[model samples]
Target: MNASLSPLAILGIVAVYFAVLVLVSFLTSRNDSNNADFFLAGRKSPWLLVAIGMVGSSLSGVTFISIPGAVGAGGVNQAFSYMQVVMGYLLGYAFIALVLLPLYYRMGLTSIYEYLRSRIGPHAYKIGAFYFLLSRTIGSSFRLFLVAVVLQQFVAAPIGIPFAVTVASAILLIWLYTFRGGIKTIIVTDTLQTVCMLLAAGITVYYIAGALETDFSGMVRLIRQSDYSQWFFFEGGWSDPNNFFKQFLSGALITIVMTGLDQDMMQKNLSMPNFRDAQKNMLLFSIVLVFANLLFLCLGALLYIYAANVGLSLPASSDLLYPTIALINLPPVVGVLFVLGIVAAAYSSADSALTALTTSFCVDFLGMRETDVVPDTQAGTQVLEENTKRKRLLVHSGFSVLLFAVIMAFELINNTAVINSLFKAAGYTYGPLLGLFAFGLLTNFRVREEVRVGKVRIPALILVCLLSPIVSMVVDYYSAELLGGFQFGFLILAFNGLLTFVGLVTLSELGEPHGDDFTGTDYA
Candidate 1:
């Protein structure tokens, strides 16, 4: 009763998809391949395009398969409980729009970490950029790894291609399209990818509904009546990972640190001509994201329902639930869509991440500035621009290799659903960024970049940022026994940030407000 796509067919579909992406890159970058165009899209990106693309980037392959799978997972994001986090995302986006956006815009920042340099100190700036590099590298690797696994299992294995070659080819395709155009090309490609991803989800849901012999309203009633319909959890108290309060708060904090504090997501936001347009993008994107996630959850329930109706055995890993059904149990068209959907979702995030990582390193570490412009006829300036462009290209190629290496590493060790692993890793890596930003925004205390400990000079901010997460890990591991069975879950980010804040306080002294200090009203 099942039909599947041939390896050649799947490869054809992927090739066609990348061909379009490459065409878009060529159109967008052929006339303008300068640093400004690559890094910030010359501050001319349409907000609506950025909003549409962000949906795909934010969802990624992790959400394409993992979220629907999570609906039946009966573990952390069981049933409709993930909606609580979505609601929290609404709140978090509001804060970013109201507070963080205005600040970044007023400062005219290319690298958001530059705010850290001006507000805190040079070391704080470097640490913030370092954490983003670490976070996005691990995060993007996890996303791409999920897609690689699916490709390997369903396509490459049949064709006798090794997993390493599969991963290299995937990264290579991304680099080919993205190295020149950067964010400008991504704005257009991500929008196209978002449409493909949503169409795949929507069509798959329709096919599943047909298989179940149910109409739309009937399917809704079935999901509402099923055991997986429960959306809120209040009886579990503090120890329950799905507790409403815990998830809601964790969701808000996660959005703040992941999107607001993150350079990968914020780079898109900053690409807009002004903060107002960026704010509109955020609001529209968040509202649409809530519905997109709901649709995925609905599809999850249908997958389970259809499986039970047909007596199909569930896959061992929930991550494989969507793929197994789409590839093996459904029509060949569904399998084709699944391949496109995952590729789109994965690259939407990965390409932007690669661009952002390159942007950060060139600006943050290499001291490349987009505003370092001179007359077109000035020979010295032209030479400097040429040198900078060469450096940018090398950095871009280096990150492409790094992403491939990291994905190969994940292939060796990753077992759980990538969404869970991604969030767990974010708790540790993004925690210090949260603390550093919060300290800069909320207080006027100046930290001594280097503190004299007896006879030696110690990097004070670095020491605090480094120590905070290690201590948080220890506390998280012992939390159940130490705190009477209280599960930290994703709230470890909050605790880790708190520890960093406390540590920073120890090395700070209250100083008279200076002209450069962010008073929260300077721009208003």
Candidate 2:
């Protein structure tokens, strides 16, 4: 006889779990804390914990929903080929450790954008920060919206909760716990969330295998015989969606822009106690992320294999596979675990983004001092007077509200493809910053002093970095349609970055800023 679980039991379990989370938040907030403590966790976090928390933070609900679907849609290329991109991520981390982290450490930067001001100009700094703001706010909302839909379908409908109410409630729960301690609080909570998410995934996978009448090793053997296990692709040329060169290059760029450059992702990295520790975290994170993704990809393959055995028609959207499979094929416990994981992934990513967005706005555009709240000495009191604590509070809180509203608006529209495209398009916007940093760090080009490039005064080299990608997009748009689908691997964020490098070189005029004296700090 089959046993079933009550809807009330599921709902009550969920409510109690969230209440515990909120209670933790209230307990952690202390009177001695200020804005910095709220934002970066006072920059005293243990690196490994922060690094692991980051894994959950990076794997959003979109990932949870999409990976399974990807297996059936494009087969092995979609599921396993992403590993190539992961390899590229490792390489990109090397650049961060060797090139980017040292500069950030030396400058004592809170927001990475400050390096732009020191290296290029105020225009560059603002431009970089603005792109980050636009990208993360829109991106984060899209992510949360994905999870909210799942919640609406599973939990809300049975209880008669409105989607809007659910969305607001979800954000509120995150803010309640996260608003006080900021990154510091998030690090601990994110670790907890990651464990929950992984536990949920492991349980669901176990149930999935059980329902399929196979053990873990048997599932692995089954995948080996399946059609979706191939890893490398080279014969399809540049236009093929899984083209090796394109994916490899894309992997490298995605890491540079999305991980190395983006404020939301890097903010967590900055929370570590020191640069060396941060670098170690980044490298370890890369290794762990590869394995984490592999788990998801394998789950995707198994979901499809199970669906085929039962003669179930695959869902129209790939994102629904994880949920549908759980609800229909597995037992009630697995279904509950699947829903919990969905919520975990969504909240983990969205909360970090909301916090990081506020941190960047406060530290970069608002011109607040980085070490304002936790100064080394009492003399720091004078610098603190320059900006009122209340005004700073208003600035952060208002921005958070605005971001929430914007994300909600985007969620209401419900266009997943357009949202995905916008995220891709926004990746191009970071090219200029990548180019500017590259030129400033690697070469002796004096962008500010070179007067030859009209009134902007920054070298034409910098201008080239800004324009190269627009030019590539225009050229590729017209010339490449006949070739094939330009497989813009979700990971090829590096190509746009390289395009920015090309632009910087073309726009920059010939000049040397004392070639031998270049110590990477002149720009910092």
Candidate 3:
């Protein structure tokens, strides 16, 4: 099962992939071409499809390359330690289904950020949405940035194409397929992509196993008996990053903030019409993700064995390990699958994020509420619908350009293993969001509604949001010296939220509604 692995051949593969995605978009959006359809898939997506689609959207190309690399050499001796974090995600998803989903559904929110507006005031709402836009822009672009570098090395540079052109073309293909139907289109596209990525991984595993002269059952035994298969870090004590408690706790908190609290991740879940279906989707995704992640870890161990056996030198950066083997050292046909798998991973994530950013900006900043619409008359409704679509198009395009620029910037300076870097950055960016929602849901407290920028009033809660992460950073920087070399790892989120919670409590007066505080509507 081999094919041409030339740069031109890779380019053709990409074109066929885009063609399939575009066909899906056209079929999905043919009848209902409105803002609602663009933002939420017209609230008609099947739960199982959405669940399967989320696997690719969340893992992306970063996982395709980075997670395998992280098995150890590509990381800080991480080994099977990453699985501890997956266990934590189960707890986080449970919280999302039981607490967050009911609130969002009851509010009839098109964008979950609306819950911020209804619970806090306008400024806090914007702050929440602003954090989402900032966090996702950097995170999504970084994921794409990883894939772009691989494509440039393997497919573009040999053919004499510029890196920026390669980057632009990748983003453009995503935009072309996603511009019309938005999430409605992405629902099916992501499902197909999810299948492509997993199948590619399974096939790659089979090939590697055959090369090692082992069957599937034998391969499992080989992995289990090897040093690379080692899991847990009990002997490393509190200071070790791979300590089970630290990774597991961090995994849970990161899942809560990054997926449960995130607009891009939650948008797909909310697209389901009811809390029951959405809850099922979340539960299914949580379980599937655990098994799916194990496969990547297994693949990581195999890559190292293959490299050692064949006398291939591992690349300087562990992030390059998977790509180096798949694209260069393996069979040409395997190289082709590697390209498809990476692209499928990249688009699943990038497309979901692009749609989410546009949705949040249009609904949160532009004040295009789900409840705001034209009169019931046919003529008036037609004009309003047209205007909404036009505005949405502009927002979507603007964010796409912004994402392209950020990804280019990342290409210029990124030097770390991408999977670790992503989770580390998320610890800071998503910490404030975790705090805001925790204080809102757990306690009946209203923060000071208005603070001032000179003569201008802003959300008083902004001060707490700003202060929490700052203190968290200070703690993280000095944590080793301050706590006898105890590394915080991902648990920085918990410390950040605790600091935020205390700050909010300190500023409260403990009374009835103030001038402009939101105490959440009691809709029974």
lDDT of each: 0.89, 0.70, 0.83
RMSD of each: 2.3, 4.3, 2.5
For residue 210, model 2's alpha carbon misses the true position, in angstroms, by 1.0
Off by over 4 Å in 3: 1-3, 74-77, 450-458, 513-524
Query: How high is the lDDT of residue 492 in model 3?
Result: 87
- TM-score of candidate 1 relative to the true fold: 0.96
Q: Poorest 10 consecutive residues of model 3 by lDDT?
A: 515-524
Q: Which sequence of candidate numbers ranks them by TM-score, best first?
A: 1, 3, 2
Off by over 4 Å in 1: 1-4, 374-377, 452-455, 513-524
User: 182-275, model 1: which lDDT tens digit per residue?
Assistant: 9999999999999999989998999998898889999999999887898999999989898999899999999999999988899999888889
Model 1 local distance difference test score? 0.89
Better of 1 and 3 by lDDT: 1
